[model samples]
Target: MTAAKRQFHADVFITLKRLVNDPEGIEIRNGLHNLGYDDVSEVRAGKYMQLQVEAANEDEALASVNEMCERLLCNTVIEEFRVSILEPQAT
Candidate 1:
């Protein structure tokens, strides 16, 4: 019998580069300080995305996820991304 293709889940985190100015993050930080959280120093806004892909192996799944991120998920010029493979949990 042929082996069934495996399904992979990818967790993508897209964050703005340090050199890029983040107005949203600054606003949040200011709010926090006003709320009495003076210890808070910096805040960075980002996006989190989950993707499901069908592939033969982990490598293939990762490659597909990376392509998706580069093409649609993240702006490579001003943003950076990280990918994590989530293992299936037991029932």
Candidate 2:
């Protein structure tokens, strides 16, 4: 066998559709109202995750993330996702 190589890092954000019901977001909006800030209209909730993956290059890393979004982390029917890749900063 051969050794593995590492390439890119990614950050993913998964959020519910604007029309979807989010209990957590509702609770937060209610709390904000109770706290005397009542100008908010609607609130949508979301989640964020960071991943460090090993791939040949940026394209491969993106492909991995795309598969992950479709198969596991995101519900494409009811939710949307945003993926951001972080290049190596420096030495």
Global lDDT of each candidate? 0.89, 0.85
lDDT of 1 by residue, 1-91 (tens): 7566677788999999999999999999999999999999999999999987777777878888999989999999999999998764433
Go through the candidates in order and give the C-alpha RMSD of each one to the true structure. 1.9, 2.7
Worst 10 residues of 2 by lDDT: 1-10
Clashes of each: 0, 0
Colliding residue pairs in candidate 2: none
lDDT computed for candidate 2: 0.85
Listed in order, each prediction's TM-score against the native is 0.89, 0.82
lDDT tens readout by residue for model 2, 3-90:
4556578999999987888999999999989998889987778999999887766777888997899899999998999888777443
lDDT of 2 at 45: 84
**Residue 13: error of model 1 in Å?**
0.4
